[model samples]
Target: MNDADAQMIARRVREELARRRLSRQALADMARVSISTLEKALSGRRAFTLATVIRLEQALGVPLQKIPAASPADPLVASPDNLGAYSQNAVRWLEGRYLTLRPSFGTPGDIFAYVTIIQWDAEQGCLVFSEAERLDSSFSQSGKVSLPHLSGHIYLVTNVEGQYRLAVLGRPTIQGALYGILTTLMVGHGSQLIPAAAPFVMLRLKAETEIAFGRIEANHPDYVRYRAELDLVTSDGFAHFPK
Candidate 1:
């Protein structure tokens, strides 16, 4: 890696460490690397090997590739006019960790709660999103905003299972909440791709809320509440109806 790449990795490491409240020693222990080695990489005194990078990724629960490097050519920062394409207020409103609600696999009435993080991707000139359970260090999917005409904002994210999924987050309501639809590509027995969609909602969590790392089991209290909220949205016909 070049010096720029090394610095990018270092910055990402620091961000993750702060977000997860992990100490350098804690990360070194988790990655099975010496404190000195971790220090050297973070200090930019040494570059990380591929194997070491993987270890750090696992320890940090962040995909290093998702972290963009600093570049002056980024249009989002370089051109003021670019901001007019999307609402800065909406951008600020949408960026953060949200507790997302979706239908449970094979259980129509059941709902699953997953944590999703959204951030501005300056290089891509769009919002980048990732979803994961608290216990899972790796993101289950990565998505980016898709532009053009739309009644609401649309995101095209690729699931870890290699399926393409689309999420449409509607404009902020008076209540300051975003309701949307989640569409997944379903493969039929004949190898045809069918779009199956479900109505869902996302509520931004308070920064102080303790985020659990493991999957939210059906028996969890949040599951019932999430299902109830989603059911309400579907019943009220508030979710985006994709034509």
Candidate 2:
């Protein structure tokens, strides 16, 4: 951290402590940082490490410092240094429309299908996704993609204010199919929304291949093929879920 960052963080920490009526020891315990280390940093005896700052931010539930803008050398790459720094060229292959499939929440033996378009948003300088061809159009999603190298998985994260919905997908297969798990809220009976999770797959849109979207029930000609694709999610080790 630079001098400016250190000063801002120290001021924010002190302000938070006073506002929350929390003692220094309480904050140290909450952030899991040693008292001596936090004391030294606060007193300007030593600089705070990046890890320490991250922990403090998490504990405070607020960002104490500014996230540096993208570097000039890689100006168009994703920013804030947390989304794996994937450049447009590196993720170019992922830019396209996908036939998204998952289990239906209202129908026990049926599937839900939709079209998801992933494309580079030049204005935002990052990849983004938006859904189409959904029966429940209002609930259709749009979000940012996170490709973290730590797990070699792709995360489609949609955050509305503080509410978040996520899809954690494995790397694409030889045929460019992405299998994963989707976590979101399902509108249940009587207009109730409940937390829901299910296996998900995104098949690359191909020329000459026909795909039907929304509420694909058994006996729909595409049912067998789609069912087999959903089965591959676990059989192929794309994602795992406890029963």
Candidate 3:
């Protein structure tokens, strides 16, 4: 979205919040967001979330459909296994490891998320690495330096603590492609992917390559079974949905 669009959305939210005599804190509480997050939305520093927008609309009895926000139907989802080959290569490079892949999840706003895990093998005594670096290498080979088709920026969570403390890394790319990947994944899964309802997935690895385990809630079903296999068949070992 452009600056003007963001400004309009923020103004609408602020106006509605004020018309309802709802304090910023109250509105944030109702929307289940941090006060700072609400501030960012109101200040036009960040795009309003789908849930937050809906809540604001309902709270003020306004019609959100009239807004110029990006449509949820804007095809952004993509195959979860599109990156399967790259993921496989990373997993193999760090051989002495037990690995797990998660299923892809799609959200209403055309966002897709998936996760994988790598565990150190007791016999190898080596640290296993499966990070964005490997994925970038693969993308370079495919002649695509960035994956904007997946989303403007992909957020990676490095650590989590009781849902309150989490370390996240955001990688920016082409918004259209990112949205396409997310939308396609949702089509393949036929499910609503929301952070509130369905939490984002994350890969688990051991500190110092000790050992790791994949969480059941963090993986896609197809990924665990045939992700690597599917990667082998993707056109040139990479799937380009945006193109």
Number of the top-ranking candidate, with TM-score as the measure? 2
Q: TM-scores, in order shown?
A: 0.53, 0.68, 0.26
Question: Which has the higher TM-score value, candidate number 1 or candidate number 2?
Answer: 2
lDDT of 1: 0.64
Q: Write the per-residue lDDT of candidate 2 for residues 10-89, one digit (tens) a residue.
A: 99888878876778887887678999999999988899898888777645544565745666665564423466666555
- Best-to-worst TM-score order: 2, 1, 3
Pick by lDDT: 1 or 3, better one: 1
RMSD of each: 15.3, 12.8, 19.4
**lDDT of all the models against the reference?**
0.64, 0.82, 0.35
- Which TM-score value belongs to model 1? 0.53
Model 2 residue runs over 4 Å out of place are 1-75
Q: Give the CA lDDT, 0 to 100, for residue 40 in model 1.
A: 96
RMSD of 1: 15.3
What TM-score does structure 3 among the candidates reach? 0.26
Residue 49's lDDT within candidate 1 is 83
- The worst-scoring run of ten residues by lDDT in candidate 2 lies at 72-81
lDDT-wise, the better of 1 and 2 is: 2
